[model samples]
Target: MNHTLLRLIIPGVFLTLATGCVTSTVDEMVFDEPSEGIGDATVVILGRRHASDYETEPDFIECVGKHIAARDKSIEVIGELEFLNALYPWFEPRTAPLKPSDIDKLMLQRPVAQKLTALKTEYLIWIDGSTVRNDSAGSMACGIGPGGGGCFGFGTWSNDADYEATIWDFTDRAEVGRVNTKATGQSYMPAVVIPIPIIAPVQGTACDGIGEQLLQFLSGHY
Candidate 1:
């Protein structure tokens, strides 16, 4: 991969899932229900994964909490790490989605056939992202093709995904408001395109470019 090109292309564009950053059009929500004022609202930033990625970044929830603080300092925000370990081991498959046991295990709210309990969590902002994939003839054929030829297919593997930063009113995990965003990334033939045949730039560039869409969403809620 061409490191220089990637560095030039990807940085400053952050639609990153780990940071709860998205680059979507802002959807404004006026606090009409009045459970708690936005200024005085206290929140716990949560980063949920497919169970695969969560294990590596245990403090990911906290990372997002920092971004929230960047957005609006008026609200009292905190990152609770005490619950991180329990949430990592269990997860529902992407096909089936997360189950009640899964949520209970993560949230530490397990009780079989339990009666409803009201939660003091006035606002639970669930920050997560969806995956987007693009595979094309150029992507594969270029990879195998001669180096210079590879650069020609640079944009072919480009695929875009929309990031979602959802606000769930903890009354029943009801989704109140959300910001949606899209991040696009592509695998390019870097060795072929690079002036010096560097590999690191190629990989970094694609990953970096993916963040822009995420940053857009974050610009709004903050």
Candidate 2:
């Protein structure tokens, strides 16, 4: 990790209430996921690193990050950005713009370009470029309400989403496989008493459901 870049990022991250709240802990589902054993790999959960995005609550990036960190930093847990040394150097927080970064220019450095190093990481796991939004209002209404319904009902819901994952080997530093998986799950909340029927209940959260799908997918891959 670049100390210079991390310093700027850590403060920015701590600004958010949830920042640093994520423990480098692993989830049982992800940590126990079987790995044939990546020769030498480091994987990262990639997405919005900006603090603003994470403050919104239920960020998938945390799920992915914690999922790896909890696994004892082994082959199963990896950082995706290790692929960008010659490509997207700006991920380091330098004053560089994204113009100099080219995903295509980077190759898996693990087994091909360099030997897997323990300190730097040798595997990269990417969460992919995609977002999941809850469009199931009906579910929310039925899930919550006057004697409301199940947590997955009208106001209770778990949504399905698709994020393309590109797995790269840091040892070879070359991408090995890409998988498109749907993360799905549900979050339950109490019915907020309001002034009128026109009141909008709390926003039914469903992002974690989509995240769970990603974890499940990881379980299958190993």
- The clash number for model 2 is 48
| Candidate 1 local lDDT, residue 140 | 21
Candidate 1: 10-residue stretch with minimal lDDT:
195-204
- Quick one: best lDDT, which candidate? 1
lDDT score for residue 182 of model 1:
48
Question: On a 0 to 100 scale, what is the lDDT of residue 26 in model 1?
Answer: 30
Candidate 2 residue-wise lDDT, 41-156, digit = tens: 34455543334432222255556556544543443543334434433543443422222133323323343223224335533445433443465454323235577444332243
* Displacement of the residue 201 alpha carbon in candidate 1, Å: 13
In angstroms, give how far residue 198 of model 2 lies from its true place.
19
**Model 2: how far residue 156 lies from native, Å:** 6.4
Superposed by TM-score, candidate 1 places the C-alpha of residue 65 at a distance from the truth, in angstroms, of: 3.3
